[model samples]
Target: MSRIRIGAGRVTAEIDEQGAELCSLRYGTEGQPGATELLWQAERAWPWHAPLLFPVIGRMNGDRLRHDGTYYAMPKHGFARDRRFTVARHDATTAVLALRDDAASRRLFPFPFRLTVGYAVEGSRLTVSYSVHNPGPGTLPASLGVHPGFRWPLPGATDKRGHTVLFERPEPAPVRRVEDVLLLPERHPTPVRGRTLRLDGALFTDGAVILEALNSSSLIYSAPGSPRMTLSWHGFQQLALWSPPEADLLCLEPWYGLPSPIGSDGEYAASPGQFHLAAGRSRTFGFGVEVSPAR
Candidate 1:
């Protein structure tokens, strides 16, 4: 239950060591009477604030990972979100947490890897970075992702239907969907009209809407008369938009890997969009969030 706090300017963030999860993010001037929380506070509907996804993005087929003719139990979204991370460094506006593969993790993943997460705040923005290293003598097939849920309707907005997401560019490619946590092979028409997506509760009736081939690296979320948020990413090729039906939070996930496709052999390396890191090498991915409170 250990937590670390970091802040700069009008933004402050709280990260928990249990999962290196971002538990809270708020924006307000010093000594202000009201500071608006931009991140979701876990509620009865969802029990997580912002869980990191690693070694795998979504569910493996049958909730099992197959490697070299052996099957190991792997839960949905991998095990990183449930493991503890060691605090590597901390300062006023930055903190770094590290997680290394242990006996328990190796039993599940069968690889020796190191994962480091860094959080930094400056002005009104919070940037999260991830670095994964393969130390074993063989290639490591893995995935990394960030799942941050923001408060829907924002602080000053009354109508949830007024919210919209504007992309940096038009995303006309067909999007993907999931069935029972496994990815469906069929492609569906994009919900985005030009560069804008009108937020609606009905949109998540099935599950997350997965944009496998995202064209934009950044997007803005806003509602009339409410504070606005901008999310930008680097080294992430996929995105998922999700919220429980009628829930009060919206999750914007940027990912470097995907779930095992339905009807495929349960080979771990064959999972779609998996990254193959060579021994002694590393890869990094990151995203940034900037919030502007209503004036």
Candidate 2:
């Protein structure tokens, strides 16, 4: 069993095998403070933290796809935090877990890779590192990212229904698109309101704000004046805003790739945010969230 103890306010969670084939994560025996650490929340209260999508949301729906004659099926989101993994190492403020692509993974994901997820706590910020190893030839395509959901009611979100997810930039970028599949973005960013910006369920009329190149790299979610936390997505190329119709939590995602829209090319070839790793070569992707002090 692997246990994660949060450093800040004191919260813990235990990850172990359960009756269901899906792994299970549970919080500490005693109650926790604030909201449990990012991963701890999923282990305890939110066992299902959005799956089948790569870095972004909405899985492509096929295990394998024939892209330009190549076949590959990504297991919803790239297999990482879900599959049965062993604790590579641990400490009071940091831990590392690793998972191998076995017969099960090979059948669905047709790629040989090793995923190592580590959490390092530094004061109110945690820097996560992902080291992926590609052991196959013929080039392999993959995506990576951070899907951390903050406990809402965030002091004072909004009288309105949707969350006022704000970015640190004054003007939007000129390199994004608002297509249907959620893949490669076109240029020209949109305003922060209306159907295009509605915070309701997956009713994504107000296409996501693709911050391809904004002045700052951090985005904060809060009421208006009262600030909750400003998540700094370091090394992250894109930010995705999503939430359930009436759910109390909001997810601020920093992604490496968004799935191509329906009827689009599943093959990462010529795709933005698409990554290809050569055999024996290693690749890394990372993003962090900084929990700021309350004013």
Candidate 3:
């Protein structure tokens, strides 16, 4: 129940010790609110949004995947995004949570390593960071990402079209759905720009969007009709837009790997899209979002 409050005006988060933090993409300076609610409502409202979801991240091939000479089970998305963590560091504008391999974790991920998440806020910007370290005798393959949802009404709930998701470029990407995940493919290698979209509840009927070909470095989530708040993504390779059917929030996931389509990639020999690191060696993959108000 520890909260990291930002400045007097905006951006804050309520993170549990496990590095499971939620960011508030709203105005008036309050942290994000969902994990607890989601946990409480999962059975009745979101039976599919479990808090302890595990490997391979982001919709694996047909609910199964290949990894390191063995095939394992992967939930809809990855874990970590939902597990609680222990506080590693904190002050006024920043906080860090960490998780190392424990007996419980070994049940699913039998690896000896640690994962740390850091979050910092300055002015109208909040930066969330993910760093992983290997401490065991061998290397491990892993795919990690941030699944953040900012309650819409972007600018401040004043303007109906007040919030917009702008793509830097406009080349069309293939919008496809995996068994449970969504993939945003590019028409080519480059992203398009100048295209802005207002999110509606109806767009996710088939379940997720993998955005490709974007020129804009950011995707702004604003208040419905006001310019009070906006959250943007700047360095993510693939942006996924999602939410449970009845929830009032939007999940903007910046990911590094997209699982192979269902019934495909039967061997999952390594982390779906993650590389390997040998004993004493380390590899890192992460993206950040800048939160602010709409202008």
Candidate ordering by TM-score (highest first): 1, 3, 2
Query: Listing every candidate in turn, what is its Cα RMSD in Å to the true structure after a full C-alpha superposition?
Result: 1.0, 5.6, 5.1
TM-score list, all predictions: 0.98, 0.71, 0.74
Among the numbered candidates, top lDDT falls to 1
Native RMSD of candidate 2 (Å): 5.6
Runs of candidate 1 exceeding 4 Å displacement: none
Top candidate by TM-score: 1
lDDT score, candidate 1: 0.92
Tens digit per residue, CA lDDT, model 2, 1-295: 3345534332232333211011211222334443433332444444554332332233453534445667666445555545666677877766776766789766556667777666666655655677777888757677766655555555444443545566666544453544443545345545553222334554444444455554557766555433445567555567665444455556666776655555555454444566778988877766555554335
After aligning candidate 2 to the native by TM-score, how far in Å is the CA of 49 from where it should be? 3.7
lDDT of every predicted structure (CA atoms): 0.92, 0.53, 0.53
> How many Å off is the CA of 237 in candidate 1?
0.3
The local lDDT score (0 to 100) that residue 248 gets in candidate 2 is 57
Model 1 scores a TM of: 0.98
